[model samples]
Target: MSDHTPSPDQAPGAPHPRETVQLIGQDAAQQAFLTAYNSDRLHHGWLLTGPRGVGKATLAWRIAQFLLATPPSDDTGLFGAPPPPGTLDIDLDHPITHRIHAGAEPGLAAITRSVNDQGRLRNEIVVDDIRKLGRFFGLSSADGGRRVVIVDSADEMNVSAANALLKMLEEPPARTTLLLISHQPSRLLPTIRSRCRTLRLAPLDPDDMQAALAQTNTEVFGQTDHLAALAAGSVGNAVRLINLGGLELYAELIAILGTLPRLDRQRALKLAETAAQRGAAEKFDLLLSLIDIALSRLALTGATGAAPMPEAALNEAETLTRLSGSPRQARHWAEVAALITARTRHGQAVNLDPASLVLDTVFKIQEIAGHSR
Candidate 1:
């Protein structure tokens, strides 16, 4: 059998977003950028803001490729009718495409978290990484072409790094474009955000999500619907869920919940044991996450009085209705969710036994169900 394992860093062995040539599920953002570029009102800096894994980085790279490959128009001659770029695409054989993919493009620089001397990735993008942008900009572009710098995620930058970037945005170089990808733009410096035009990318619809997964050769087979619902429209999250066997685990969790108030001790113990096994840290984390998701859905279903959709697991809707059928029960579950979330975080922080943590959370849910009865 072929190994279907994703790399530790990426999903389905797909190339880095920078090396990805296609952009999916972000047509409006792309059009807004093309409109600006075609109107000759392109800003020096662009802040690409959106949820994680929704094509922000891909759009940044696409824009970088377009800017570096397309030269500025000169209205100097009578026949100077240079076609405006309608799309952010250049041929794969384009020199800029080859150079950017190889990370050898002098006109482009990408700033991201760097490895420390100990060979581990640092937690944040430091000022020194931003300083590299200074050196990159200091050198004139070969042939005086446009320069582009991409910060894969501005949210990961340290305060010092952000301030350093702010200085550059304050006095941007001629013909330079800075693309900042931020999952949470609210966390960035207000001054930095103010200097850039914002392009917000929305989460993908189901069709787009499927297209994205297929493009990466992610083999979901029969679980596409469950994966889509569990991922909440984020392709990156879907990939992680698929790699972790989240669908089956969530189904198991819902089945256990279905026996709530009565408490299925044997099945619950099996799940807790599985999560507590050595080297199952990822599974443990995913269990806690899925529990939180299920609880949230229950609370929402109760409070809204809307028909529940069994998106994540079979019989989820009926189970939620049975467990949290009234506003009071919904409030009770919400409080339980908050308490369990805090406890779970604390348990992980203190390195508590994973089995005990899982059992504790499940018992709490059972207790709440009992009280509701």
Candidate 2:
């Protein structure tokens, strides 16, 4: 097995999506594809739509492995052989699986954002990246097998890239399959979406999430419940939260928020200073994200007349209720969330002082809460 370790910036101990063989919480999608394949009505293109990190890529790989490994069913008209495959699994030692693990499969092509001259991943998948598919399709399949193309996320494609892909979907080649993964399907071109068969994956329930985490060998033994709540059923999000110490930071945030209307200047200043330290950019960004989540929860609680289930800390539920019990207050916090989100993005773009930006956001929240009373 080739190395499938994630990068330093990625979730620690988590394998790449392609390396994940057993998909959890996606039986419906698996069964759908099986039905299509067995009935010989499988479409050329598949759109996997769901929230981030719910095993879209894993399912794509599974399909690709099955397609490449399994031969096309013969039309012997009842007396040929056994029934069609009910599952996507291929033998672990299959040559196709090994080739895919090493990314050496001639019949497979993956389109994702490429690295620029600076050695950093590009912000979007450009047209040039999509153009490479022409060469990929130009070559005949090595063993006269099916050709597979995977776009890890269709949402990251720019207009030109998306248009380039649309052309392929318009006239796909024989025995070729294209799998497009998307976190937000609405952001894609309507024409592209309409052309593909969609398979939507829902967030995993707690039991399924725990099973998924265990399959990945994630060691969140005593904290599965907390991680489940914070991650909102995304295994990727759960891993990231654990790696970034997000739970602890969020607890500190709720602690500060509990003193709302009067806002703890000393504690707030300390948190801001910590985020402003050199080489703490990720921490700073995480802090900003946590703040937005807290505000969103506050707004949601007030809007729904239901207390938020405590995720970060035990006092979070009471804190949310105390600060935003009325719909009017909820509206105010929602507006504040919007403003702070915009402000924080703009500040980061303009290279504003991180410490100052954090302070400003807290102060704005405090101001809103004070008047909300």
Candidate 3:
């Protein structure tokens, strides 16, 4: 595989998880792992489970670094054993750290979706990908040092590949630690889930999100709350939003909704044309997602008597209140959202013109709004 092939594990325009030296807003998960290590009861297999972009991969990298760098229960005899590790942080300039950054760490292996014979990255981790570890285990074992293997997402492993991994978990090699990062543990085999101890990570709060973003040099000036609300505390999602001007797009969407019942044709046309522009496919997909978000918020506002807080876009609450002021209206919008989403997605699948598809979606929402009024 070419070294420059974009990794499936890393988000676009975001630093690779291994490049993130520190994992922020996950102290509880870190503590749990530390508790396992300090007690000398560290499991051979670890499953780090959490939402996407919540630092599961980063935590795995952290654990790998800690295991390889820290000497195992040093036995000095007369000097007595050293104290247990209280944190996962190691010196950033340590040789092990340096090697890991360079992807030259002999004791570490990171497995993601691998390129096939055609040089195309496969969507699933094939059995061959898992089998390659057999070779890795063979070579790394000669050193007799701790070895770490990180599977970015065990969920993406095919059945055969998973079975291969299952065998390793069944009889793990000496001084080897397997870290599995799973965004959705339910998709994994029950047997696989049962074999490993789970360390669960949670979403970051706004402050933590800001700090995490800053660590990557992603500075958001006055829109932290808005971005936090929109991203749901996922740094990966936050970066995508920032890279694609999602905030401005979402705000424009809300403004269009504000003109509902008597929808502004000119404004709607402008938005649709923007989505149709060349190289705007990602933006178009995000626009559809924002529409779904608006509809869901409308439904939620009517049901709960309030809009979801921190407002993902300007004037969103006002538009939601005006358009879905009652449960009946909210239900109407929900049904409209479902039908329109399915139809538009199908149109997109069939290569429908982007401008018309987006415009059609807006008109349908306008029809629903007119009825509600």
Model 3 has how many clashing residue pairs?
0
Q: For model 1, how does the per-residue alpha-carbon lDDT over 1-373 read when each residue is reduced to its tens digit?
A: 1133322223444567867767888999999999998888999999999888788888999999999888787543576767887899899999889988887989988888877776667779999999987678777554577899999789999999999999999999888999999989999999999999999999998899999988777788786777877888788888778878889999999999999889999999998997888889988998999999988888887898753553678787888888888898888878888988999999999999999999988998898889886
RMSD of candidates 1 onward, in order? 3.4, 2.8, 2.3
lDDT of each: 0.85, 0.85, 0.89
Residue 312, model 2: Cα distance from true site in angstroms: 3.2
Better of 1 and 2 by TM-score: 2
- Residue pairs in collision within model 2: none
- TM-score for each model: 0.91, 0.93, 0.91
Candidate 2 minimal-lDDT segment of 10 residues: 1-10
Clashing pairs in 3: none
